[model samples]
Target: MDDSALLQFSRQILLPEFGIAGQTRLSDGCVVIVGLGGLGSAAAMYLAAAGVGKLILLDDDVVDLSNLQRQIAHDVNHIGILKVFSARDRLLALNPSCEVVAQPVRFVAHQADAWLAEADLVLDCCDNFATRFALNQVCCSAQIPLVSGAALGWSGQVCVFLYQSGQACYRCLFADHPESAATCSEHGIMSPLVGVIGSLQALEALKVLAQVGDTLHSRLLLFDGLHQTWRTVQVSADPACPVCSAADSP
Candidate 1:
């Protein structure tokens, strides 16, 4: 690492476990953000600020006037613009050295393999359940870690799926809730609620990337902003889960 780079992340390098090596790992990692909404905005900003080398920002929606209320990365000037571009600009302003790739395509299966194939970590910040399940399948197939977060109406949840040998995956936790999933647009979300959950998602992603500290693998974290309380529940893998169970079908 050059003096300039060292000077940039000196605080992170000062840690006992995260010396120059951990900083190097972060600088060499690539992560994909699957949405540019409230959760994605906060998560992407923190990820870039923490020195992830490359960020793949995937979102097909355009910034709307209403997004300014909660999507901190997008401003009034960005209204009608593609979200990925606006988020990329904000992230670059935080750390110019990080590479940001903006993809303005709807997240779909046909394009999933190419985009997620080389990612070290993937963050599922999308609002709907279908997108979450699709991203889970992709990450499970690629054996990449996924940091998932969601918030709607003063409530939020964050969890990590390691795709490790014996850990439970995302599909295992919510196999039956796909039909009842709610969107921030329809249900109304508290602006800062997403920031809180998304920030935790970013922190989990950083830990997974740097290989430092324990992650929320196989455990679901719930944040109730209305009541100002938190809860954690352990999750177990389903032997019949179509995604993770496929690994043993051979």
Candidate 2:
């Protein structure tokens, strides 16, 4: 940690729990962020600013005009460009020392394991249940920590799964996809809602990496932006969950 580096993270290092040690951990951490949309936009920026050593950005989509409403990392200039590249450029601008790897690809079942091979933590900011379920399964099997966040229609939710024995994996909460899943285009989403959830995801990821403070581990946090209220509930491991059941976890 040089003088400039210390000065750059001085505010964070000032926290008693964080200090120099936590800052060091953050400077050495590597996080994989799936999805460079609204959620990933916020999470990735904060993580990069906080000095996470490396970030792997994954997203197969291209930036569109409609995305400007919430996706903060990209601008009009980035329209039609791959989301991963757009976010990578922003993250690098935030912290030049941070190594940014941009992968213009979606998270799929087959690539999950390989993508996360070197990840110290993963931020699940992607939409859709299939990717979420696959990420949960791979993270659980590998015993890696996962921070998942979702935002849709003035509401959002976040959960942290440490993948420890008895902890709740994502599949433990949503075993199957709903018959009528809402679409962002149809239902609409608030610009700030995803920011809130994404920021929380970043916070939880930092805590997990720095080993400081109580994270959202084994807990689900729900935010109702319309009502301006927050709720939290304990999540337990599903004994029969095929993804994280005792029989399946190593």
Clashing pairs in 1: none
* TM agreement with the true structure for every prediction: 0.96, 0.97
lDDT of candidate 2 at residue 55, scale 0 to 100: 95
Candidate 1: C-alpha RMSD to true structure equals 1.2
List where candidate 1 sits over 4 angstroms from the true fold: none
Each prediction's whole-model lDDT (CA): 0.90, 0.92
Top-lDDT structure, candidate number: 2
Give the number of colliding residue pairs in candidate 2.
0
Q: What would you estimate as the lDDT of candidate 1?
A: 0.90
Top candidate when judged by TM-score against the true structure: 2
Write one digit per residue (lDDT tens) for candidate 1, span 1-250: 8898898889888998889888899999999999999999999999998889999999999999988888999998899999999999999999999999999987896788889876999999998888888888888888889999989999999999998776888888888755677677788988898899989999999999999998999899999999999999999899999899896457
